[model samples]
Target: MRITLERSNLLKSLNHVHRVVERRNTIPILSNVLLKAEGNDLEMKATDLDLEITEKTASMVEQAGATTVPAHLLYEIVRKLADGAEVSLATATDGQTISVASGKSKFSLQCLPQEDFPDLTAGSFSHAFKLKASDLKMLIDRTQFAISTEETRYYLNGIYFHAMAEGKALKLRAVATDGHRLARAEIDAPSGCENMPGVIIPRKTVGELQKLLDDPEVIVAVEVSDAKIRFTIGSVVITSKLIDGTFPDYQRVIPANNDREMRIDCADFTKAVDRVSTVSSERGRAVKLSLAEGQLTLTVNNPDSGSATDELAVGYDSEPMDIGFNAKYLLDITGQLTGDEAVFLFADAGSPTLVRDTDSENALYVLMPMRV
Candidate 1:
């Protein structure tokens, strides 16, 4: 294959698909990105078995062929070349190496046969729907942080996306949890997704897809089936395999009645936890929150590091309650709250507590209380 493309154009195309290329690969083809030159354009495709990203850039094609080359190495070479320089790529005599050229620089890089690059069979994503880019991003950003990193649970490692239509409205929902915390975010479903199966999209896939959804002006076309999902935007298509484990019924973990309610300004609450947690160096980074009669105090005590206490005025008229929580967990929940106020509904120190944005009931958060 041979193509002469502007350096900026090539680099721009490479950056889009770079994230899906795995740095460590057991298979040689998986470590390389497939580059196809023909028909007035060059296509770059990369995959890590679970995810695949394909992008194209306009190029002056002189020959029609495809080859695989190291993704990062190609990116670096194009990135370091003189700005606006024209880059020419041609196959070597043996067709086993690709010759790259720019101003005052030329190199031959080892290439793998394009026949060896595995194309993930998209496998019949028969359902196609259009979703707002902003809405999809909200679904991912709000819940991705709660996805579990522990692979043993297997099921909890991705965001659960499913369809639930209630009272004349079809709701698209995303839920994620690591057993200690959980997040649920939703958006109105576009037309024709009422029968979509619930799928657990792996965390890495969610992150990589988010990058593609960053454009607010674009709308993402979502195609899904039992085994995979594809998000298409512009000329790019990102396909990811769905995690094959069954996500536990997280609905049971969501508390129905937690009555020790407290309403506090979000900034004040997060700050109090931050200050009190300063002394909790050895106590598992735990901070205790005691609420009584509109008064809230945060306290942290560590045997080797002494203690810290900070108090804030809140809206609470319930029974006295003491709850323990991990500082990191507290921060993650508080960071997602966009408003100034956060409402905490608690049953007791041992029971799960529910949090909500005072203005909207659509988004709710449940945080499991820790034992101090």
Candidate 2:
């Protein structure tokens, strides 16, 4: 393929698609990106068997053709070119190499036959919907941190998405859990999502989707089937395989009857937890939280190291109680809170604690306590 495009445009499109290609691949063609030049655009595609990303950028096509080249290598070459420079890519007649020329720098990269690249065939989709970029980003940001990394329970490795009716309104909910903590976030259900099947998006796909949702003004089109999910964001398209395992009923784990309520500033609590956890041992990062009438004290003790203690005035009127939690988990939940004040509902020292932002009704968190 022969094409000429502005460096900025090519770099932007390559940045989106090259990330799908794995650093190492057993199949030779899987390591290269498929480049097709036709019409007034150059389409770039990369895949790692399970996930695929495709992006198109406006270009001046000199000859209609297609080829595959090292994804990261091409991206690096375009990235190093001077800003505003025009880049020219031409496939040699022998079909063995692709020449990249920009200003005074030129490089030739080995090419693979475009026919050898594998295609992830997305069978007919069962459901399709459009969501605002801001709403989609919010759902991902709030729950992605709790996705389990354990390989045994592969079902919990991705955020669970489904549509549910709450009171009189329908809501689209996203839930993620790592056995010790859970994060749930929801938004008003967009049209065409009420009867969609519940799907577990893989962790890597969630991360890549999050990065693509940087523009708040764009509208994202999502298509889902039983085995695969596809996201079309502007000129970029990402298709990924959904987890095959079933997600557990997360509603059973969310505490709904915790009576003791403690309202504290989210920022202050996060800082206090971070400060106290500094002295905690790496194996056990437990931080003890003691609450009384109107005071909350955070303490971390490690026999191998020193101890730390921090106190903050909170809006608590319940009986005194002490609970231990992983300091890192606490910080993760608190960091996602958007409001200044956070409410924590406690059932007991051993039971799960419920946390919610005082100003946001769309998200909630449940934390399993750690014994001190």
Candidate 3:
């Protein structure tokens, strides 16, 4: 295919789709991106069997054709080219090599036949809805950190998306957990999603979707089926296979009867936890929190390293209680809270502790305690 594309335009489209191409692939074609030029646009597509991304950009078309080339190599070449320079791509008559030219630089790259590229066939979707980019981003950012990385319990390796009744209204909820900690966030359910089926969006898909939601003004169209989910924004489309495992009933793990409450400055609490954990061992990284009538003390002790202790004045009026937790987990959950104060509800040192942002009612976190 012969086409001319602005360096910036080509680079932007490449950056979006090239990430789906694997660095090493058993099939040669899977390592390349399919490029098709027609009319006034050039389309780029890349896939790694489980996920696929396609994007289109305006280009000057000289000849209508298509070919496949190494995705990373092409991206690098376009990235290093002079800024604002126009890049021209023309395939050889033999259809085996593509000549790339920009200003004073020129190179030829070997290519595969376009027919060899596999097609990503996403079946009909049962549910389709539109949501603001900012809302979708909030749902992902609040819960993505808690997704489990363990391969054994595959169900926990992604974010569970479903519709649930919140008081008199139905809300869309995202929940993620790794056994030690769980994060839950919800947004008002969009129209036409009342009958949507629950789906487990894989971790990779969640990451890629985050990149697409960077523009706050953009509206994203989401389509879901039993086996796959698709997201479309403007001329870009991303399709991914949903994990087949069933997610456990997360409600059972959330503490229901915790009555003791404490509230502290979110930033101050995070900094204190970070400083005390410095002395903790790499494997354990546990920090002990002792809460009393009007004071909270954080301490960490390691056999090889010295101990660290810090105290903060908090609003705790219940009986004195002591709890141990992973310092990293505490920091991660605290980082997601946007308000100034973080509220914590505790039952005892042995039960799970519920945490929330005092100003936000839509998000909550549950962290299991560890023995100090």
Candidate 4:
């Protein structure tokens, strides 16, 4: 393809698309980015087998053609060129090499035939809707940390997205858990989104799609079928295959009846947990919380080192009780609290503890306690 594009505009689109390219590819064509010049725009695409990302940038097209070139190599070459430099690309008649040039530097790189590239089967989609970028970003930010890294329980490796109807109103929910902790958040279901099937969005796609949702004005166009989901916004489109296995029934795991309740400032509780857990080594970062009428104390003890304790005034009036929890888990959940106060509902030291921000009733987290 013969086209001329400014360095800044080209680099912006390349940065977003290149992350989908794996460091090593079993097939050489998978490593190259397919560039096409058509209709006053240059389109760039790269993919691993599971996910594909494509972006377009305005460019001056001298002739209509297409070719595949090394993704990272071209990115690096254009990155080193002076700011505002014009980049010219050409494909020779021999069909063997592609040439790239800037003011004084030139590169002749190997090319792969465009026909060899794999085609994504979007397959008959039956659903489409529009979601606010801010709402979509919040759902991912609150739950992605709880995704499991364990390969054996492959179904737990992503956030579970589904729609539920409550009293004739539909709610969109995102849920994630790693056996030890769980995060759940909900928002108003977008109009016409009540019928989309439940899907487990893989961790890699969650990360790549997040980068595209930063703009406040961008409304994500979502289309889904039985096997795949497609996200289109502006000149970019991303397609991903959903996990076929069923997700666990997360509703049963969420506790509803816990008599004891404690209210404390979220920041103070997180800081105390961080300080007391310092003595704990890599194996167990456990901290015990002792609570009674209007008083809370956090303590941690390690045989190899000394112990530390801190006290805070809280809003608990239940009988005296003690519970042990992983310090890291508490910090992660507490950090999600955007308001000044947080509430914890507990059954006993052996049962799960439920937490949420007093100002926000839409999000809730559950943590499994550990024996100290």
Off by over 4 Å in 1: none
lDDT of 4 at 185: 88
Q: What is the TM-score of each candidate against the true structure?
A: 0.97, 0.99, 0.98, 0.97
lDDT digits (tens) for residues 263-297 of candidate 1: 99999899888888887875388889988897998
Q: Write the per-residue lDDT of candidate 4 for residues 6-70, one digit (tens) a residue.
A: 99999988888888888899899999899989989999988887889999999999998899988
| Candidate 3 segments exceeding 4 Å error | none
- Candidate 3 achieves a global lDDT of 0.95
- Please list the residue runs of candidate 4 whose C-alpha ends up more than 4 Å from where it truly belongs after superposition: none
| Model 1: lowest-lDDT 10 consecutive positions | 357-366
Model 2, range 111-141, lDDT digits (tens) per residue?
9999898889548899999999999999999
Q: In candidate 3, what residue range of length 10 has the lowest lDDT sum?
A: 118-127
Question: Lowest-scoring 10 consecutive residues by lDDT in candidate 4?
Answer: 117-126
Q: Each candidate: RMSD to true structure?
A: 1.4, 0.8, 0.9, 1.2
Clashes of each: 0, 0, 0, 0
